[model samples]
Target: MEAVQFSPPLGYVFDPTDCELVGFYLCNKIANKPVPGIDYSIPQYDLYGSEEPWQIWNFFKQRLGEERDDQDLYFFTQLKKKTSKGSRIDCSVGTGTWQGEDGGREIVNDNMRVGTKKRFRYENKDSDQHGGWIMHEYSLDQHSDYVVCRIRKSEPALKKNKRGKCQEVDSEKKKKRSKVQEVDSEPLPLAVPPATSRTAPTTTMVQQQIQLEDETRGF
Candidate 1:
């Protein structure tokens, strides 16, 4: 099978952690033969040149139950670009995150809401200074006519409670049931029947006298 190749969008901003374009390069296997320069500049290439790009795009979109639009194309292009640079990327669509100050919204603190407005920012872990901030607004809810970029939160660190313990609580009924079972398993005292006295019955004297009279009459 011919290997798949992805090309990045022109002049795309690179992000290490949250960028989507980077993911495509890592996933798709590149062809061994050099791609002609003309192919690179084209808006779309034959995923399997035998098939149309829209057809392949539609196939994926159908499987994902997503609309295949310009945003999706742009997203794929960006992914291709990111991969070319030796950065890592994911194959699946995901919630994207924008870090740093540039292309980011102003930090808003209100009674109900407080946080930086949704914006793309750059952060460098290696640098001594915190990365520069840029502000830009994005329509996360809207599907992009060009390329849709979705932001998502990264994994958060597990935090310990005040007592440095994180324990899951069981229902009260379960605790009671366990206690009952434990008590039932232990040995218990055996019950004994109470003792009772018996009395003997006496024979009637009239019956004995009658028997003696009958014997005397026979004599």
Candidate 2:
């Protein structure tokens, strides 16, 4: 199967929310059911390799046009179980490691907590200058086998900066949150969208029920 590029291809926009990632796509992958664009949208990879972030971005990024996802790159990565146990994420990838920020938070799908998506910052020995890059790691509550990471270069607001810069970032964040909430609260549909399009999340029972429905729908 041809893999989906990280960036949107011609005549299409690939914009998915936290809810859709955890509720729909991640759920299907955990259940071993077929995700329509799994092979393309999110290819399997262990991103903790030696390759630099930009280098990795180039590998999965869209080469069709000037359009690109400089801030976020999606990949289906397996969670490495430590011999010590207890969900200890093996963070070492190359010369840097991704450090989790602000503990994990729950993401609800149709009023039910489907999973927790955590935010992590990249860091290295030389300097903590890697703050420009961020990783949003999503893993189902029950299924911890594999995760989908939305890696992007996000520069935090500087303390010395004025209110304008903060406002801009806040606006973008508000729009993102609004979009995610809007998509998650909607009801499930019988028909699925096309592969080129990034589908939205729908209201459902628990993840298992949603999984069954997805299987029946062949989405």
Clashes of each: 27, 4
On residues 1-219, what C-alpha lDDT tens digit does candidate 2 reach at each position?
234454444565446899999888888887889976566566777877777665566566644243444535677888775556576768766578888897889998789998998888777645433554678899988887778998776545222233555687899999999999999999998897666535866545797687888899985
Model 2: residues with Cα > 4 Å off, grouped in runs: 1-9, 62-66, 69-71, 84-87, 127-129, 155-219
List ranges where model 1 is wrong by over 4 Å: 1-13, 16-137, 140-147, 150-153, 157-166, 169-181, 184-187, 194-219
| CA lDDT, every model vs. true structure | 0.34, 0.71
Best TM-score goes to which candidate? 2
> What tens digits encode model 1's per-residue C-alpha lDDT throughout 79-160?
2223566644322211222253343343222432222223443233332211222222222112211122332221121122
Q: What TM-score, to 2 decimals, does candidate 2 have?
A: 0.61
For this target, which candidate reaches the highest lDDT against the unseen true structure?
A: 2
Q: For candidate 1, what is the lDDT?
A: 0.34
